[model samples]
Target: MTPSRARRLLPPLALGSVAAAALTGCGPDPGEPWAGAYVNVTAYPYFDFGAAAAGQSHTVLGFVVADPEEPCTPSWGGYYGLEEAETTLRMGEQIAALREAGGDVVVSFGGAARDEPATACADPEALLGAYRQVLDRYEVPVADFDVELNDLQDPAANQRRAEAVARLQEERPAGTPLEVWLTLPVSPAGLSEDGEDVVAQMLAAGVDLAGVNVMTMNYGESRPDGQSMVEASAEAARAAHGQVRELWAAAGQELSEEQAWRRIGLTPMIGVNDVPGEVVDPEAAAALNAFAREQGVGRISYWSLNRDRPCTAEHGDPSEANDFCSGLEQEAGEFTRVLGQGFGD
Candidate 1:
């Protein structure tokens, strides 16, 4: 995986250039609380810190480091940075503030819509180096790879990502491991083949993955009519756990169902999922929370915190997924409160 000398010459991301930071499960040290939600960095100030405080979602998974504008380069969705007009807040400063408030951040890379470094960076060593630079800048104990769709289907990129992360783990300081979670698309049947393969590849690459976070929402054309979203999510979690156990066992490290569950994370879209007619309401959130606790699941999060409130006006089709509200009838932070139940325990 050695890169050309020219590639090695590429400088690390300038710490000051990156914007806001994030958090989730910190590596195998196990004490890090896993309940949280994705918070977009640019949505800061508008993002309610009070809800996070109230819900006890001390860890936030921030989206995203889109893709390198160039090889081995890292940027926050290709727009946000320390530049004055890029964003009104500094990521480091905001992260510091969150830390001060007794919270933390874990930055997630890739998403359903963005180009990811694994898919874009050709040199494996350079890509690994780029990820290292991002971790160094953020100074967080966890990172998430939100691979989906095309990126999820690309085995080459998936293998490269696993190797890169394995290299990072090898370089970690003793007792200061970096937790890596692969967040992938899921359905009631559980992780798609590509999702299972990603986990297998990571294990094969010697990456001690901290967990697998399933995006258990928006089942879309795959979902049956009138199916409970909560039930769908639970089924998906169980299926994923089985897949992880089999993969780990095949990799010569058998994990009990409970062991696998502790490394599992559930993230349902808060209110209206992108799929028409699918909604994960407060009752569903409560059910998921109970399920998470009973199963000892490590993390529970929603699509976002910014959308924790009910839409108050006809800004758009309140029935669809939007930025400001959860598209459901409830007080602000209701979903947060229910889903984050037992958080910080």
Candidate 2:
């Protein structure tokens, strides 16, 4: 989703917290099993934060933050501070609950609308410190970098991010390794030059990057008319697989097609995309799910869990990019049921 569009869809913040049962002890265990839909946390109320435990997702990728006020200082939804956000949104509690239920979270550091510490912080040492704080706070097994637009354009910031992460991995305790995932924008043609550069820099810095998760929606002018979103996404994945293979080889980590494809991830925007005429309905989701399983892709996720339901009559324009519903005909959790099948298996 576009940053401007995200700003419009998110609701105003209210300060508070809902008390719930919490899980004791938190730390990364490298042996933990993770798979299934990766739902974004901030898009709540629509998904009923507590109720989502019963859904198909085995992992929740919390929207942007480890420390909201570190380095350049970040905030949730451009409003509440990270503390208030956790208190009011019960994000930490949700993580505890998901973990108690045998699921976990991968805290994401950036998104379409926010400033991640990677670009905001100039000092590599301080950036590494910021990442360390986030890691220490959540003790998550994995973290994600969602780079887009201007962030993708800055080479220096990208390198700084890679260096910081490499340092973090180097300093990790003997048995626990924090896996990193680079989520980037894609078209039918595949990863852009900037996208490939991000991967190259990470490899050059010796960061143990788990893989690349391509955002396979909003093709804009790149997708041909009459082509299904499923077809477009499949073609994009194929293109990304090839690019990753060639880039890795250049970095002296030559990998076969199977190895390259296995390290690839697919994240299509659920339902109608930011661009019109690009809807990922149930049928399309099933096709993508089948393809993901066939390729043994590393991960399968969508833009959000909040937009997983059908738009109601009381709701406003379906094309307005509202975060509460899919703007398409789908029952609650139906999209997850269809798209998340066999994921993380």
Candidate 3:
């Protein structure tokens, strides 16, 4: 399982700030190269997406899944409905604040913890409507679907999601089209057969995919025994880059090598990974950032902003993967600072 899935299955844990106000929307242009970290909206110790950290101001707030009681309805981590989240979680305010700070957010759907709307709502129209609601509410230009675990193998769910997203795009007003990205699990070898199929389904369904952001962590046995995390992740990204180009070519859309890399994103699980003995330390993060910048990788994001802090005494053991803190010795926001370098240039 991916880190996000594993972390969610564990017991809940507790878990930003402003920049040059004049530079609002000064980050990468829409559909262009960008970087940010994931924020578990309903997680504890509410994160401020509006604040700038490490020269980066963009964020991907997510895992919005179907409401447990009402599958067709959208909820924040299945804990609060859209309206309730606005009032209780201050989601709207936070997003507004982030945008005001000249940053933007990508609302992610379908996470490991709960059923994505498409998985729960079988009706294509209903699924489309569910996705539309969230997109309209957030008014975001980008949406990420983090498909993993069993969801990756569910062909029916995958097809439904692809179709729904395609229709959602068509229905959007011109000049305000939505860019959909699939955030999938990857290993050093790159996308699994299921992951590739998911991409093919999206392309076949006519969804103008923005890119494939590989979760470059928790490689388990995929990482060569002696290779460092950075090396392994770099390998995984390179492999995925090739696969993405081939996949697009097979779909009748040929892209150059540079173009393929531009359509690729790398998101590592910062600090300790769910897999034992695998840790992305601060140095590793900086190396990964350097590699990304050198390769012109489109996006660089970590598993979470919530886990970016060091494990404090109150947070308990630093050896285990905790929900709130990264099980590593580092300053707060260290990963973001290191990984965000050169992004949004």
Candidate 4:
């Protein structure tokens, strides 16, 4: 077994505490959890981070992946580089505004659409540098890695990513160490074998993992017959909690049930999921949120803030997954309002 990473002296901040600190104009405690939704950084019809959705002040801006052209360079959704994003998309300004408004953002790396940096950047130093650039540029306390598809199966890439992130955490000062979370795909049964390996690699590499956030949507054939999306999501999270505890035990760390739950995050794709006939309505979202609160789940988020609203005529079909809007009848931010309820309370 790989030696355990040196544990930080400071305890991780809870989701409520982090929100409270940010609202009070203080920097967040180095590590913990929070509730929010993913914002597709380069998606059409830009989202304003300064505005709180349903009084929820935190968000995860995502898909900062390797630039196809530069390989090691980071770009927003493979389109806008850091500087270009600031100018073209007002990316930096929006984040600054959000922080100024007593809100915080967690920059997410990788997504289903593009290659994570490790897939393209083979050099360990270069991979580390690529991650460093984004974290430093955002000045964020938390970073989420949404690993999926072929990228999740690449052992070389996963090793490089784990090492780079581990180094990133170790290099930071104790007071402001980086908190990393691995976002992986899951089904009702729990994390796939590859997903388990990903977590193991991070622990083995000494990445002080904040938690494992399973994408609880799109179970496909894994969804049991007659099960609702909410039911499937809840089952997946519950199963993941046990798997996470076991993984920690294998690494010489034993987490209690509550501790394990606090180390798990659930992110469901709101409205119409990519899979047919799977939908997370507002009521389902509320039920899911209630469950999270009751169980002390670490964080709650959806696939995107961008798609929280009902689809318009321009979006074509309301039954299909649309990037710009949730494919159902609902007010703008309704899902956010429901899911974010009591998040930091």
Instruction: For residues 149-242, write the lDDT of model 4, one tens digit per residue.
Output: 9889999999999999999998898888777889999999999999999999999998888899999887899998999887888899989999
For candidate 3, the C-alpha RMSD (Å) to the true structure equals 7.3
Error of 1 at 19 (Å): 38
Tell me which of candidates 1 and 3 scores higher on lDDT.
3
Candidate 4 residue spans exceeding 4 A from truth: 1-32, 52-55
Q: After TM-score superposition, what is the CA distance of residue 91 in candidate 3 from its true location, in Å?
A: 0.5
TM-scores for all candidates: the values are 0.85, 0.86, 0.89, 0.89
Off by over 4 Å in 1: 1-33, 43-57, 66-68, 81-87
After aligning candidate 2 to the native by TM-score, how far in Å is the CA of 20 from where it should be? 42
Model 1 earns a TM-score of 0.85
Superior by TM-score: candidate 1 or candidate 4 = 4
Q: What value of lDDT does candidate 3 attain over all alpha carbons?
A: 0.79
Model 2 clash count equals 1
Candidate 2 weakest ten by summed lDDT: 10-19
lDDT of 3 by residue, 1-345 (tens): 222323331011010111111212211222667778988776665556556332355688877888889888988888889999888778888888877666778888877888878888888887888888998888988899999887888999999999999988999898988888899999999999999999999989988998899998888888888999999998999999999888888787876666677678899888877789899999999998888876666677888887889887876678887667888889988788788776652
Deviating ranges (above 4 Å) for candidate 2: 2-40, 43-47, 53-58, 65-71
User: Model 1, 1-345: lDDT tens per residue?
Assistant: 000111110011111111112222222333343687776544523444433543243455454543445745766655554243124545665676677666667778887655678888879988887788778877878888888878888999999999999999899999898878888888888889889999999989998887889988878767777778888888888888888778777778766555677678898888886677788888888888888877777677777776788886653677766666777889877876787666652
- Relative to the true structure, candidate 3 reaches a TM of 0.89
List of clashing residue pairs for candidate 1: 19-91, 20-91, 22-105, 22-106, 23-105, 23-106
- Candidate 3: list runs displaced more than 4 Å: 1-30, 52-55
Higher-ranked by lDDT: 2 or 4: 4
Worst 10 residues of 3 by lDDT: 10-19
